[model samples]
Target: MTTEQLKLRSMIVTALFAAIICVLAQLIIPLPLVPITGQTLAIGLAATILGARYGTISVLLYLVIGASGVPVFAEFSGGISKLIGPTGGFLVGFIPGTFIMGYYMEKTSFTFKNAMIANTIGMFIILAFGTTWLKISADLSWTAAFAGGFTPFIIVGLIKAALASWIGVLVRSRLVTAKLLLPIKPIVKEESI
Candidate 1:
């Protein structure tokens, strides 16, 4: 395939991953008032698979799609209103989170240990951005913002990060192996009768 075709294919893959993450974000874990979603898992996975640049682009596309009233955000909501809401910070944070994950994935990372380290960094970045933004946008104190935005999701985030890293590396390794094993076409020659 040509370079352009390869790039197109890469974008498509990134979009698909972002769409998957949006859908996954709607899967709410029941709680009293606030609920949790598996959104981070999708972000990390996309970044790990797509690498840094494509992963960031995929997340940006996801935000655009969600902001365009597509009902793809959590609870089937979308638009600018949601973009500026309390959860918006976390939503925005996903871009950097994905970037972090993809950055690590591109380096010397195949083992679960490396994945763990990479995902941890990604998760922390997401939390930092989300918490800080939450404080500024919502006009809440740092402690309160973290209490609302970060505390509830700690365990789940860790789990998601581990899962994304492990699964991503495993799949990437297999893909590499498959490509290495693919047979090359042999040229055929006809002899004169």
Candidate 2:
């Protein structure tokens, strides 16, 4: 493909992943504040497949859409309030988490082990930001925030992370083989004395 074609393809894929995250966000189990949803899995999938730059773009697109008063968030919630609301931290965290996951996936050989580690780390980033935001937004203590935002979601988060790692990596491999997605170039880092 020509450079322009490649860029177009990348843009299309990034937009598609953003739409996927929006659709998946609707699958919500409503809770007091932070709800359980398929968004994390979708986010992970996008990051793993699209790599850091494109993956982060996809997530940013989703956030922009939601912030623009589109009802693309959990339970069809949107607007600025949703962002400043109790669970908004999780939404903000998505950017960093996606970038981290995608960056790691690209830097490594895209192995399952690496995916798992990256996804786990990304999950924790979400939790950290989400829980902190929950505490402040909800005016809860740290322990209460952990209980409400972090603790309740731990098991489900792990499951989503695992699924995202394995399935996203598998799908990426297939797409690369089919010449549909660009292959990630492994990044080499040199340690300085």
Per-residue CA lDDT of model 2 for 1-193, tens digit only, reads 7767767887898999999999999898877767899999999899888889999999999999999999999998789898899989999999999999999888887877888888899999999999999999999999999999998888899999899989988988897776677787797898999
TM agreement with the true structure for every prediction: 0.83, 0.94
Give Cα distance to truth, residue 62, candidate 1, Å: 0.5
Candidate 2 colliding pairs = none
Best by lDDT: 2
Candidate 1: residue 38 Cα off by (Å): 1.3
lDDT for each of the candidates? 0.75, 0.90
Tens-place lDDT per residue, model 1, 5-113, is: 5566666677787788788989988653235777788787777666778779888988999999998888888998876876787788888788877777566555677
Model 2 TM-score, all chains together: 0.94
Q: Which ten residues in a row have the lowest lDDT in candidate 1?
A: 179-188
